[model samples]
Structure formats: C-alpha cells, structure tokens
Target: MSLRVAYGARRLFVYLVALVTFGAASPALAKEFHVLAFGDSLTAGYGLPRGQGFAPQLEDALRRNGVRAHVTDAGVSGNTVGQGRARLKWTLDGLKKKPDLAIVALGGNDMLRGLPPAQTRADMDAILAEFKRREIPVLVAGMLAPPNLGPRFGAEFNSIFPDVARKYGAALYPFFLANVAGVRALNLPDGVHPNFQGIKRMVSGILPSVTQALNAVEA
Candidate 1:
C-alpha cells in the first residue's frame, strides 16, 4: 500500500478507538475550541506529570481567560522535524475534527541533534503548507538553537519561524520556551524539560499568540 493509504488506515483505527473511549464526552469536546499542540518533548510534557504537560496547562490557561479551548497533545518525545512532517497528515486525519488552530512548536530536537537547519526549514514549510491546504490556521511557536551551537546555527534556526510564518501568513510566537529555557528553577532535574513553573511560564508567553490566533480562527 502507498504510504498515504497506510497512514490513513492507521488514523482510521485511532479514530475508532478514540470514539469508543470518549463516546459521551466527544460531543461536548467538539463544542469547545480545538487546538492541536504539535511538537516535541516540550509539548508532550516530557518529565512533568500527566496533567502538567504543555497542552493541558495551556488549555487550562486559555479557559481561565475564557477561551474555552481543548488542546490536543500531539507531541512525541524525541521527534524531529522530519518525523513531524511524516506524521502530519495522519495526525490531522485522526482528529475527530480538524483543529481550529495548530501550534507548530518543533525544531528543538532538530537543533539538539544538529540536523541541518535547511532540512528543518523544509519540513516546517511543508507542515505549514499542509495546514494551509486544509484551511487550518497555524500558530508557529519556535525554538532557538542553543547558543553554544554558534551564531550561524542560531541564525538559521531562529530564522525558521518568521520565515515560515510569513510564508504562510500564520501567527507567530517567537520562542516556545520564552521565559523558561535557561531558568534553572523552572526546569526539571535534567534541565531540559520544564517543571510545572516552567510550563506555566511557557503558557503565559504563548497565551497571547494563542488568543490572537484563536480570534482569527473565530473570525
């Protein structure tokens, strides 16, 4: 079977199981604003407990401010931009309904792995294109390469966000880890993933962009 067909099938299987599991709750969830958090360990809430992940925390923050959102955590730990591209289609296909907004917060792992910024740019471009094709609004929340990687690497990596966001005319959140990245108190023991406080800081930083994107979606 073609890769597309295989992925579509997997999505269908996922939809069936999700249907069974969230049967009664599905309709209510459907009524809420839907946003998809698509990225890496950060979005997946790597080290922190289940409820403290980026998606959940962000959703809570949004709702508190009266956004009434339901954010889906589609992040997979250790996933690169390439992996994100490969799964993009099926991830949307499996959504019970297409998200009103998709937060593209990837490229961190790519930086960590020293993957070419060109490759990251390409994958991000494709993902943004697909979102546009499906009429899904995108919110590009970018990650900066560690400064130790050198100014050249940081330049290329940091440019990926504005470049892609402008290319797609999507909303942009300059840094996904804005206030928490180097805050030792906000990070986990590994100093990579954020602790709850860090996640809160992240949510606070990203919330305005999210609110703006959501407003656009509603419009």
Candidate 2:
C-alpha cells in the first residue's frame, strides 16, 4: 500500500488492458475465419476430384491472398433454391460455430427445372433473412438464368440475387459462374458442372469479394 507500489500496479494494469485490446483487434492475431459455401452443384464440385471443389479451392485462394480461412462446402448436387432454404438450418447446425462469412450460391437448379421466379425469390429471401437475423455477414454468389430461359424469366430470375443481397445489406458477386459458364472446355461432359479448370476460374473471380467480406467481418 505504499504510494510508489500503488502507482506501479496501476500502470501495469493499464498496460495489460491495452495489450489485451490490441490483441483482440489485430487482424494478424485473429483466429482462422470460417466461411460457409452455401449453394448447389456448382459450389459442390459435382464432377471434380477432391480438393478441386469451390470450397477447398476458395480456401486455398484465400490463404494465398493472405487471409486465413476455412471454407465449409454446404453445397449439394441438384439443390434448388427451395431445397437450399429447407436445409439451411441443418447445415448451419452441423458447423462447430456459426460461419464468420457465408457465401449464398443457390438457385441454378431452380432455373434449370423451370421453376417460377417468384418461388426462387422467396426462397432466396428466406435464406438471406436467416443469415441477417443471425448477424452473419454474407457474400451472395449470384446465379444468372441462362438466355434460353426466355427473356422475362431470365430477367426475373436474375434479379433475385442482387435484390436479395441489397435487402440484406450483403455483398454481391453478380454471377457465380462468371468467366467459366457456357465455356464448353471449362465444363464437364454434362455441361452443367464445372471441370477442374472451371473451378479455378470461379475461385479466381470470387476471391476478391470473399476477401472484402472477410475484411468486413474482421472490422
């Protein structure tokens, strides 16, 4: 209880508090971020080999760009937007912790099956709403209805991703397929699934948005 002793103790406590605060806020000291790739076959790597899927490839890409991330593949082949919404809670429950960032990439199958655009929009809205309710940051990996789907249907289906993303205040990567879609060489024989090269291209295109989303999560 001497004056000098009390003063030293106070200073030490302040120093410790500052250290703890900095450690918590410093990105360099942060734990690995968990990212959920919540989508369908394109996100699932349907025809590709192990480690070549969107989730794994994206994880590797994030690391290469200096962000520590573990991407979980919640993608299932043949999943429509409605199916994705149905399984959303189950998939989230399976994770050890809630994802730091979620990439919503569903609806391709819905378009392929010729489902109504309104149904697709509703399913997407519910999915994004759940994420928002949980306070999870999202990067919507949008899917564009093919030109063959007819102009009106394509317009309506295509509008769902951006509109939902805006409503949820989420980041949008306009088209998940981007450079790889419709390229015969980049697709598998079935022409719906991406090949190894296609996966790489997709990863490259989306890496920037993923990084931005992680930055927001950290912030």
Candidate 3:
C-alpha cells in the first residue's frame, strides 16, 4: 500500500477504537445516581406544589451533602401496599432509567384502611423482594399506626418494615414522620398529613437515613 493510504487507514482505525472505548465507559461515566421515592401521599407531596414535594426537597438535601442524585417522586395519593404492588411495574416502566436506590415509603394507607397487618407485611415483602431481584438497593421507610388503631395493630404494622429490612439486608428509616408526628404546627387540618413546614422537617429528619442508603448503593 502507498504510504499516504496506510497513514490514513491507521488514523481511521484509531478513531474507531477510541469511539468504542467511549461507548463502553458511558454507563460508569455518568456520575449522577437516581433515587426513586416510592410511596403514598407523603412521598407524593399531597396538597403541595410539585417543586416543594418531598422528593424535590430530599434531592436538594442530597445535593447539599455532595451526593449527585435525582429523586423521582413515585408517590400516589391514597395508595395502600396492595395498590403499590399492583402498580409497581407500571411505575417502574415510566422511569426513564431504573433507580440506583429506592426509598420504599409505603403502608400508611393500609393502616388507615384497617387492612390486615399480615396482608400489609406480605405486600411489602413482595415489593422488597422485587427490588432485590432487580439488584436495586432499597431503604424501607416505616410508619407507626395511629393509637386509635389499637396497640396490637400498631405494633404489627410498624414491625413489618424493620422486619423486611432485616430479612433483605436493606436499610431502614424508622418512622417516616418522626419529627412531625404530634407537632400541631407541622400538620394540616386533618392532623394526619404534614403541612409545608412539617414536610421540610420530615425531609430533614429522613435525610441522614436516605444519605446512608445512598452510601450503601455507592459501596
């Protein structure tokens, strides 16, 4: 082959090789992680603006802590664990990218509806199992049943989350409403859901746990 032709062919080969390398490294090259905030009205930011929801606020908090992550709000108002499981696949399909970490903040609606504790646990177990099967790290956000639900019911409902976390080796954020539970200023007129300020407190209280969950994913 002529010298000029040989030089041109060699340069083309090098370009092709570089392009292939870049393609192979693309996934790891993307530094931002995705966190799917999967839950009920609490995660959905019921009665609040889209930008002020728990997911966005939590995303902001994550950024402040030097973690590059986008929190996808997957909350549906008045959803029970059964409902969440029924719609889980549809929700996953809607995501542009599968989440690296998922905060499973559900079951409160089940408690409110007086669903069987065993049923609630079973549904949650299935959800957690699905996440594990997909190799997605999960942080189970627990909820305490109202005292009016009876002591036995409260204990059973609250125990489901921690038990599932332990079984699946997932992170646990006990009591999703920890800081704003009885705080009158934090709740809305219903006394169940938190108001705007209460939501901020909720985000702050759960930030550490969510951060820890993200660290697990990084590890």
How do the predictions measure up, each by TM-score? 0.85, 0.87, 0.84
Which model is ahead, 1 or 3, in terms of lDDT? 1
Q: Native-vs-model 2 lDDT?
A: 0.91
Model 2: ten consecutive residues of lowest lDDT: 23-32
Counting clashing residue pairs in each candidate, in order, gives 0, 0, 0
Residue 115 error, candidate 3, Å: 0.9
Model 3 Cα lDDT, one tens digit per residue, 1-219: 999999999999999999999988766546798999999999999988768889999999888887788999999999999999999888888889999999999988898889999999999999999999888899988998888989999889889999999999999988999979889999888888888898899999989988787767766
Off by over 4 Å in 2: 1-27
| lDDT, candidate 1, 58-126, per-residue tens | 999998997788899999999999999999999999999789999998988999889999999999999
User: What's model 2's lDDT at 132?
Assistant: 91
Q: List the residue pairs that clash in candidate 1.
A: none
Quantify how close model 2 is to the true structure by its C-alpha RMSD in Å.
5.2
User: What tens digits encode model 2's per-residue C-alpha lDDT throughout 45-126?
Assistant: 8987888899999999998878888999999999998999999988887789889999998988998899999999999999
Q: State the C-alpha lDDT per candidate.
A: 0.91, 0.91, 0.90
